[model samples]
Target: MSIEITVSELYDLKETIAAGLLEGLTYPWEALPKIHDFIIDLGESLPKDIYEERGEYIWVAKSAKVAPTACLNGPLIVDEDAEIRHCAFVRGNAIVGKGAVVGNSTELKNVILFNKVQVPHYNYVGDSILGFKAHMGAGSITSNVKSDKTLVVVKGEGISIETGLKKMGAMLGDNVEVGCNSVLNPGTVIGRNTNIYPASMVRGVIPAGSIYKKATEIAGKREGYF
Candidate 1:
């Protein structure tokens, strides 16, 4: 498919504090390895009145609600109005954006969740960049690694990008809605406003404004209701 799923195409830079990190990169996945050092550098600049340094290089916005049971590691930023719920595990190199929700049992690693993004309930997102308002349903997860442990390659019809990274996950564009119990395979990229059906096994680049019923059936939003 001939599509533009670049980082700038998929996300609004205004939605995340990690915008500076992504701005220097072309593809969203390119930001993964840099997230660790980026978070450390960015966290230091955050105003003390707005955000508090909790642990080693971990910044939590005063307006954010983080449950006491949540486990947070270094190089993590929880932005304003974000909610890190009970038993949430933030494994580090993660940014929980403004008004975003990281619900119970959700695990995040090396991910940038843009404003209002929600990965609530039984979700595991790693080495991914979720755009503004993207929402993953309960039990949905991003499978970041290949079984054989080689580099991840983003693939779509007429498109192939060799990422040259062993760990990479889904890239969900703005307002994308991933259905429940779905598994987004490594290097998956869902474009803006796309919706994947429940229990779907999705990989490759799903075009913007499409409804993915299955691997064989992808219909534009105008064709049917989600």
Candidate 2:
């Protein structure tokens, strides 16, 4: 099988607390529904000295910086040294990984952002999983629901996998960089070490280590990039 959009292919599980939850799961989106209960269970086990419970079923690392203007709901865990900027909205069932950044006016729901991921500035991410160090540029967002509201399906080259989810979002692999104002359509899977151009409307599976300029134009990274 091609190593394209599978859980193992898209993420380094060692980077998140949801590692065990993702194990044996063929697709990363499979873990979306399990995130809520998992956070509650995980929060209860965190050391009191390091993680402080804010309201019900919420754990915020002592070292994390959360702006007073930010709104954070339950079933959420903000990891060590992460930053939740002013007016950020975390709508629950979310895990913001160590050293990650949820910047000004960004909204997140039912998502897991691995270590050092950044969704800074005017981003709306829902029902998604962002791998280690993935960065979404300003004004970029994940379009989580289709206008027709049909079950989401992951479409790759010569293959299609039904996700059976009506509210799925994008899955961004490690070190992926999405340019400004881009929109990742539902069931979009961007592979590791790839770069997407600014203001692009992206969908389907983008190969690992590639540079996506447009739907018809994608090129592999330069030899020295690796």
Candidate 3:
């Protein structure tokens, strides 16, 4: 039997928790339900010299750049050097990693974005975890709910693992590049170093070091293409 992909396989736990509140969880999504509570716990521990509580359960780093037009709700942390572009809306329960970009018109909720991750356009990322350097091209978004509104199932290599949740979104691994105008369907799990072609509708699991050109066409990463 093939070993199923878990959150640890795709994300560096140390990095993801850099600004997060959860301490121990087997799956990334397991942390979702506790995000709001955890933020309240962690916000109290933030150093006053580096972090400033902007509102209820919301902490903004002293050096973070937040545009005047941006709207940030509570239970969130904007780390040092992170940029919240004009008109950005961070609903809550989000940890924007250092040097990350939450771009103009972008919306985020119940998400953890690792350092250097970029969603610098009109992106809607919710109930997800974006790994280090993972970039969502303009107009790319993660669709967290299934059309049928059933619990999500992650399938790869002919095996399916039930996630037991109805609202699980995409898990984008480190260095994953989601091309422009693409939609990552519910329970999508793209492995490390993979690239999704522009305007593609992606679902299920995309293996590591692969290029997803379409639903039927996925190619292994060429050695020299790196």
TM-score of each: 0.97, 0.98, 0.93
The whole-model lDDT of each prediction reads 0.94, 0.94, 0.86
Residue 15 of model 3, lDDT score = 68
Tell me model 1's lDDT, rounded to 2 decimals: 0.94
Error of 2 at 149 (Å): 0.6
| Superposition TM-score, candidate 2 onto the true structure | 0.98
Off by over 4 Å in 2: 1-3
Give one digit per residue, the lDDT tens place, for model 3 in 1-226: 1132566677776665443443455556676677778777877988999999998888999999999999999889888889999999999989898889999999998888988899999999999889889999999999999989999988777768788888888888888999999999988888888999999999988888888999789998878775
Ten residues in sequence with the least summed lDDT for candidate 1: 1-10
Number of the candidate with higher lDDT, 1 or 3: 1
Better of 1 and 3 by TM-score: 1
Candidate 2 lDDT, tens digit per residue, 39-78?
9888999999999999899899999999999999989999
Candidate ranking (TM-score, best to worst): 2, 1, 3
Worst 10 residues of 2 by lDDT: 1-10
